[model samples]
Structure formats: C-alpha cells, structure tokens
Target: MGLRKRAAATVVTLIAAFLLPLAAQAPAQAAATAWTPGISPLHDGEWVMRDIPGGDQADSWLKNCARASGIACVSVGQGDGKQSIFHLYKCGTRSLSNFIDALSVLNNQTGGAEVRFTGPNVGTYRAPANPNVIWKFPNAATYDFNTMSVC
Candidate 1:
C-alpha cells in the first residue's frame, strides 16, 4: 500500500511538473501577433505599398503579358519568409492563389508599369512602377488582396 501510494504521488508530481510549464506558456502562445485582429492595419483606400524574400519555390504563372516591353513580375512574401514569384502579364487582372500570411509584395515589373491591387475594403492600391521595389505590409497579415492588375 505504501509503495503504491508513493508511486501514485510520484506520477502526480511528474504530471504536475510537466503541465505547469505548458500552462505558463499557454498565455504567451495564445497571445495574438501584430497581424491579428487586435489592431487592423488596412483601411479603406489605403495604399498597401506604404511601408516596405525567399525560401520556398512557389512560382506562379507568368502568362499573357509578353506584349509589354519587359516582363512584369510580382512576388508575395510569406509569413515564414518564403516567397512566391509570379510573372504577371499586362492588360488583364490576375487572381492570386491561396497563400498563407502574405506579408509583403515585390513589384518587379519593368517598363514603368504599375501593379494594381484590389481588395474588398481596401479598394485599389497601385504599386510603384519602379522595378525591384519591395513593399512590406504594416502587419503580418494585413493586406488580403484578391487580384492583381498589371498595367
């Protein structure tokens, strides 16, 4: 009986010891990031390029815009710092794939062509025509742009 009681007590102690630290870390883990709903970074008619690279290889299609002087490209920055470079054609709107944590956009369009980003609430925001310019969103998941219109 004594040994059983001791074994039960030891098991309880071990369980408590393991769970205490996790409990302590639970709040921190549950804490929301800057991109979370605690604060919204996007506003109506706000330019997503107001602020500011690459791991995974998720290259999107670069079809149809070949008529332009230079190839226009766009890259989406993922939350884990991985990026997907998309070759965009001009004269039409392209829908983006479902990407996780789109933190930034790189407008690598040439010939001084601006890439227009359209969202539901944010309206239309045009990226700079300058090639190789990177635009970072204010938060990690701020701008949820639906389509890109390269001109």
Candidate 2:
C-alpha cells in the first residue's frame, strides 16, 4: 500500500487504543457517583425506604435542599416528581475532603463510621462525620428538599 495509507492506518489504531480505556472507565466513574451511603442496596442500617410526595417545586430540588439544610445537601426527586431524597454530605465548602474520606471508608472492610445527628443542634458535617444523615425519601415530601432535608 502507499506510505500515506499506511500512516493513516497507524494513526487510527493509536487513536482507538487511547480512547478505548477512557470509554471503559466511563461507567466506573459514573458508578462512583451513586456509591454514597444509603443508596447502596447491599447495606442494612446503611439504607432505608421512605415515602414523600412532590407537588410544586420540581426544577431544582437539590437547590431547595441547600435552602432547607441550613448547610449543604444535594437531592433527587423520585417517580417523575413524586418524591424527593436528599444526600446531605459536606458543608459544601468541603465536598472534596468528604468524598475522599467516604471513598476510603467505603473501600475498606471496616465499612464506615455512622454519624448521628439526633439533636436539634446537630448540624451537617462531612461524611464519616455525619453518616447517619437522613438519606431516604421523606415520608411526606411537601414539594422539594425543604421537607426532605437530610435529617
């Protein structure tokens, strides 16, 4: 074959090799997104089911969580806006640190420390810091994260 054709073939092979690994890694990276506690179907005390209905607030429930938690939290509404479940993690100012701490504990056999925010004064803290935060869908979602604020 011509030198130009040979060169083109080599370039295509190199490109495929480089892109294949990244494509394969995409799912793993996305899997980590939902690895946060409570969502895992495997854990017992680590997860629970709650029911809350959605009414008006529909566009940005996570934003509503930020408003309600009085700290920082992210959320996802269920059943096409039927309910909402918030994942309250770091104080927002420190998500990177919390993610690192959580990943370490989750990857370890020791599991992770469960943080108990039972008292009214018990505010949002980093993961491994506040592992027991309300993550399940609320019993009665009023509309957005306001009613479902993580614990």
Candidate 3:
C-alpha cells in the first residue's frame, strides 16, 4: 500500500482498538449504575399499589401517602378499577422505619385488609396494629403492590 494509505489504515486500526473495548464495556457499566424506575436511591423502601379503583378508597390512600413526610407516591397509570396502578417509594433518610409506621397506621385505618406485594419477591401481608412489628424486606430489588379490597 502507499505510505499515506498505510498511515491512514494504521490510524483507523488504532482508533477501533481503543474504542471497541469501551463499547463492549458500556452495557456492563450502565447496568451497574442503572436506576430502577419508581425506586429511589436515596430512599430505602418502596411499595406499589395496583388495580385500585378511583373512589373514596383510592382518595384516602393518596391522602395518607401525601400526609407522610417522607413518602413519594406516583400514579403509574389510570384505568378501570382493575387496571389502575400506584407506585410509592421512600424518599426520607429514615424511610424504612417510617414506612413501617405508615403501614401500621394504614393497617389500623383500613381494618387489616389483605395487602399483596409482587415482584422479584411476592407475599401477602396484613398490617398489624403494633407499630413494633419487624417488617423487613431486604430484597428491595423490585416489587409491585396490589389490593383487591381496601387497605
């Protein structure tokens, strides 16, 4: 090849060699720092309520959530009672403790209705009146909340 052509080829090769590895690593790096939607890094707790109909019950839930100082609530979507979804995340430094307290209050206010949580972890819980109940879900990786009845 001519010297000019050879020099240009070498430069292209060097550029690719330097850039390819970074391109390959982009996904892993992104994944490591990826943010889970509807969950906050600053907050240590999350809850989702799904399929709630718009009514006094939904209004009450939203009201209570808003009243809490550290809780953040998002309406994921709206639909018929069976299709609505609400997501709540803890935004306070003391969120986990506060969450339990809120849950206890909810349990009392709603009369122990069944609260269902689904995601990487799935379970059903009834809020106990006792604020001391040790409610722990260390795996906050992912979750969705749903309740057929008022909770």
Best by lDDT: 1
lDDT of each: 0.48, 0.33, 0.37
What stretches of model 1 exceed 4 Å from their correct place? 1-69, 97-103, 137-142
Clashing pairs in 1: 52-134, 52-135, 52-136, 65-89
Q: Mind giving the per-residue lDDT tens digits that candidate 3 earns over 23-138?
A: 99988876564222222233234465655544456545555554543333433223223212233332222212112111212222223333223332344443232222322232
Give a tens-digit lDDT track for model 2, residues 1-151: 9999999999999999999999999988865553222332222223222233343333234334434322334333343333333333322121111111111111111134232222123233322323224333332221211111121
| Model 2 CA deviation exceeding 4 Å by range | 36-151
Q: Would you estimate the TM-scores of all the predictions? A: 0.46, 0.32, 0.30
Looking at model 3, the pairs that clash are none
What is candidate 1's CA lDDT for residue 94? 60
Error of 2 at 38 (Å): 4.5
lDDT of 1 by residue, 20-129 (tens): 99999977775432221111222233122111134333332212222234445454544444444454444566664443355344455566677676667667667666
Summing lDDT over every window of 10 consecutive residues in candidate 3, give the lowest-scoring window: 95-104
List candidate 3 segments past 4 Å from native: 35-151
Best by TM-score: 1
